[model samples]
Target: MQTTRLPHDGPEISVLALGAASLGSVYSEVSQANADATVQTALGLGVSLIDVAPYYGLTKAETALGLALQGVERSRYTLATKVGRYGDKAWDFSRDATLRSLGESLGRLKCGHVDVLQCHDIEHGDLKQLVDEALPALRELKAQGVIRYVGITGYDLAVLEKIAVEQQVDTVMAYCSFTMQDQRLGPVAQRLKSHDIAVFNASPLGMGLLTRKGPPDWHPGHETVHKAAAEAARICAEAGSDISRLAVQWALQKAAEQGIASTVIGSSSAVNMSDNVAALNVPIDAELLARVEAVLAPVRDLGWDVLPGNGGKAGS
Candidate 1:
């Protein structure tokens, strides 16, 4: 695994970060021992950044992560978690709520201060509130050495871009995958790079649609998204690469090509994690990339039409 410098002069982190959402019971249930083993395995594989949030599994993810890092050197890893959301629940951006969230997250992770603290999924209306209220507190914490950097993450690239332009945060995390499926963040990536703000892309696999199992209509919004995913899979197959590998490689390659800092992939099992890591080694030829793009050309929005709260239920 390669390491990249954090934006705003913070610590360096692994290019491939391990997302802790799957370690919790939201997607599937894992024994505490298994979670610990997975965390340890990721560390051994040179993955230094672990992303978790208090809302994941109702704080179970953070608890599991804390237990996993109990005996390890805290400085060896760059820890990150979010405030402004709670447990598959709703989003809240109040100043007092932000403080309360951080306190609880720190207690759950058993850490005095986190390396990076993010404002999770803040919308346009809440942006000013965040800058006015949360920003001061976060800056205070950073000044006191409680946190090294501040970041903002969300599914909407527009919100990310707005924050990156108006705020001086250390990093910004967005969702960008291969196939130009959602080009929403393309410009945002360039903007962040110019500002020296590290960008972390999540959902490289588009929420498991690029895997061997193909897409599923898990929810109402997934109906059209699954169809688009299947089309992408077919196109990848015709081009000599599976959708799974292509999706991961597309993100890693694009991030490297564009000079973004890192991309995060969520994996529940060690086998799945290994498969994702193997994508870093897969060779994506010009022909394959071209064909993949052609196949995805017809669906420019790429099912973002069904995104939650956008008059659809994708994220819901």
Candidate 2:
């Protein structure tokens, strides 16, 4: 496992991180034992960033993670959770809601304070409110020792950059915008680095578009995007490799090179999580990657939010 240091003297964390959305059963139900193993296995593998959310599994994920982390040294990892959005349609970036959300998350996580506190899914929240109320609340918490650092997470790269630079936060996390197929975050991340703000990229698989099984029906990518990914998957398979493996390795390695401090991957199965870590060790086939890149050429730098027919916020 490789590591990268956060900007502004933040703690060094693993380049690859563990996402707990699956443990919360967002896609499907996961047994408690499996969830525990997934978190523990990631830790044993030297994963230092564990990201969860109050909206995930409606709080089940945090509770499960709390139990798994019991007795585990607090210094072993950086814990991150989100505020603002608490459900699919519920969003509150107000000062009161943000404060209440953090309190609930801490109770569920069984931790005195989280290392990083982020404003979740800002694309859906009222931006003026986030800036006027939510961020101030988070920074206040940071000042009071309730959290060490403050950040924001969203799906829009441009907005992320705008807020990161304007608000001057510790970090910014954007998903599905930094994968091999969509490198839109590269330039934005570079600029953010100049501000000494650490960067995090989630869903390097484009939230499933880069997977072999293909994007789910709810995925917002156009049909053309799906076809391109399918061809890339086939090309990798013919080269005796899996697209998921290449996708993970490409995201982690590429992110590290692009000034991203960490990339978060979500999975419920412990075996699957370990396999992802192992995939990083297997050298990425250059020719195979090039071929896959060619296959994905048509949709290079694409994002569902900006794609036609998408709700602009769905499938992220």
Candidate 3:
């Protein structure tokens, strides 16, 4: 596995990271046994950065991840979990809430402190409070050695770009905007790299849009977006290939080219875990990738609003 270091005196991590959303059943219901197996599989494959959130499965993700990491050396993997956005629509970024959220996350994760503590879905919260109250609280936690680094995660590229370039956080993770079907994060991540802030691009499969089965039923993408993805999947299927493999490889290659630290994808099954790690070594066929990209051309950078009514990159 390839390795990279975070900016501003952070830990070195594997380029392919593990996302714990599936462990918490954010995408589907997963048994604790499967979650445990998945975590072990990720560690076995040298995936060092593990990203989870209190919002995923309403804090169940953190708990399950905590159980999975039990007895493992704390130094073996870099732990990251987010605060705020506790539910699908619940969001609070007050200083007290931020502090309380981390406290709860620490308890749920069964750790003294997390390596990376991020403000989750900042665009969904009051921007002013997030900048003033939530961030200051996170910095305080860092000062107290409760968290080694501070970061932010959001689906809004504009919001992430503004805060990542101007704020003091050590890293930023933007999802669903950096996949094979969406290349907007390429230039944005480049600009972020210039500022010495590490970048993490999550959901390289575009939150299921770039898969053979297509996006989930609840996906906020447009009908046209789903159709284009299905067409791209068909093109890959005809070539005896999986669209997800191509998506993961393309995103990983792009991350390396753009100097992004790691690409995070959630896996609940051990097979999926191993497959994702193996994807880094697989060669992406240029002709096949071009054909898939051509099929997805119409929906390039087309994203649905993660937080509807916020004027985000919806239908753009």
Clashes of each: 1, 0, 0
Q: How does residue 242 of candidate 2 score in lDDT? A: 85
Candidate 1 TM-score to native: 0.88
Q: In candidate 3, which residue pairs get closer than 3 Å at backbone N, Cα or C atoms, i.e. clash?
A: none
Instruction: Encode model 2's per-residue lDDT on 162-189: one tens digit a residue.
Output: 9989999998988888887888988888
Runs in model 1 lying further than 4 Å from the true structure: 87-89, 176-180, 215-222, 234-241, 285-289, 303-316
The model with the greater lDDT, 2 or 3, is 2
- Deviation from native of the Cα of residue 300 in model 3, angstroms: 0.6
* Residue 43 CA displacement from its true place in model 1, Å: 1.4
For residues 229-285, write the lDDT of model 3, one tens digit per residue: 899899889999888888899999989888788999978889978988898898988
Every model's TM-score: 0.88, 0.95, 0.95
Error of 2 at 164 (Å): 1.0
Supply candidate 3's per-residue lDDT for 214: 74
Candidate 3: deviation at residue 53, Å?
0.6
What order do candidates take by TM-score, descending? Answer: 2, 3, 1
lDDT, candidate 3, residue 178?
A: 86
